[model samples]
Target: MSRCVLLRCAAAAAVVAATLVAAACGGDDTPTDVVLVTHDSFAVSKAVKQAFERESGLTLRILQGGDANEVLNRSLLTAGDPQGDVVFGIDDSVLSRAVGGDLLEEYRSPELSTVEPDFANPDPHVTPIDHGEVCLNVDRRWFASRHVPPPKTLADLILDRYRNLLVVENPATSSPGLAFLLATVATYGDPGWQTYWRGLRANGVRVVDGWEEAYTQQFSGASGSPGKRPIVVSYASSPAAEVIFASKPLATAPTAAVEEGCYRQVEYAGVLRGAHNEDGARKLIDFMLSERFQADVPGSMFVYPVRAGVPLPEAFAKHAIVPRDPLQLPAAQVDANRDRWVARWTEIVVR
Candidate 1:
């Protein structure tokens, strides 16, 4: 769900203060706190947080270290002496970089046995929590009002009609942005991806720093005041969020994801190396994989739980899309080429 933090109104301070205040009021004589350092997109209902704290006998503290890339970058800088016990929201887009930098401590959870094999991490270092597809989400209303068909594939984004109608996050700063860039690479390959980016630039695509700005400000399909851009880089599950969070109860979402060029993203959590509360950290990871957590995933974060049998919410079941053949590049390939690709992308699109 962190592919696009679905809670449009919740602020980072609000999420932190709520969790911290609950921990402070807890009646434990000597409370042991396990810190979870993750992206700003992380969210869970208060009930779920209280349940985890009570069940595990651990005070759960959260440290939202910005977006996924910011979280990973901060962890890499303080690799051994991490700021928290567990780090969540590091997806396949940057998982190899985290492992290569020795940012996580290996702690294979028993809960992993129930995870869908497709979402399982082969390495014991990280546990997959949830998965989703990052795709171009369009405002169906916007297209309809203009009497123009929305773009359906990566190739369609560069068309003349869609010019200045698409907004994207900068891959260097955002995970979904990076996943989208990888999607282009997986779709167009090498020189072709570069050409595609050049075409996008020529077609007047707008690039923002992160998902929040692109989706909430520039994207037309968001709940509040609509922006000019009809299409944006966002999650496949975003439509479900739109329907659930709408001002009024709606039968359907105003937005829809173009599944043809979607990119699959699997978010993971792991114990940080040299954590003060390693035991508590492992417990937190296990709790994340528990049914209570996974079951709340769709409503809380707008992502599909990695646990195979977790049922989806009505909104997700009705409005969300699961791409049949989402685009993906192996972690090793992404890790090796990420820097060069980002630099080239900046050159083509930003510079």
Candidate 2:
């Protein structure tokens, strides 16, 4: 071929290649992607995330903060143009803030029928996924060896010889810590709860900023610690964690639950009003609420599914305890009174 003809052929080839690449890269306008923002405790296996990708035909991205309150607060402050398409793991403790910020779309999931009505809050903003009782966690062997009796009741923590040895997370930063605080208010009215905290403070309690630090740094034989405080705040299902994460199969968990003032905390999911893919976000929420997901929840997240009829594994069925009357102060009341209550609590303890 002559030089001029060869040069023309190369030029045509370059034009075709550019056209093909344009088509591959979305041609003119491709669908925008979305993100799901949640806390670290939130769990979903690779299979579930893949199913969402395949079914929704859009990429699923996750934006995680250290915990639900952190993610929720950030989302709330940026609601008009959120960083994620959906926000999850918010519970009654943070629902008021979420609602106050108008961060959620008015999404009434059709799957709500699968869950118990009480847990599903009648309002159409958020949907409950899983629930657990927040209770005192005790290392059974530690107490047994020391011959120091573990606290058996809310009152016991203040009066019993176990007083100074307790480790707790700060309510503003820890989910379970906040739930337990709410429980005290429910178990004893506001002023009475204040009185109780004053007593607890006098008894020499140690408070940390979050649950992970309190549990692992201060509590005895936690996941990565060599500490000695026998009592901590965690889910009642923590005993099963010992069996599941244990180095070997054991007869029973090394820990036991102190159930007297257990506070029930239920987690929820909501579609962000700014979602780039609204229907896809709704579908993901539906998938989370499905029976298959609920059944796996106990072992994966250490919580009971709110979806009715989902059977728990033998471990949860055998070990998880139900409080005679789990405490709950309605979300509305909690929101209305939290500032005053927390202030009063701080004055009694920190001052």
Q: Who wins the TM-score comparison?
A: 1
Candidate 2 lDDT tens digits, 1-351: 999999999999999988865553355445445577898887777776677677767677778888887888788788968877778898887788888888989888888888976676545888888888999989888888888777788888887587677888788777888888898899888678888887888888888888878877898946556867888888788877776777877677788788899999888888887876677678878878888778878877888888988887777766667566788888899889887877777777777
How many angstroms is residue 103 displaced in model 2 relative to the true structure, after the best TM-score fit?
Answer: 1.1
Candidate 1 lDDT by residue in tens digits, 144-181: 98899989889998899999999999998888899999
Question: All predictions: root-mean-square deviation over Cα?
Answer: 9.7, 6.5
- Candidate 2 positional error at 198, Å: 1.1
TM-score of each: 0.89, 0.88
Pairs that collide, model 2 = none
lDDT measured at residue 282 in model 2 versus the true structure, 0 to 100 = 86
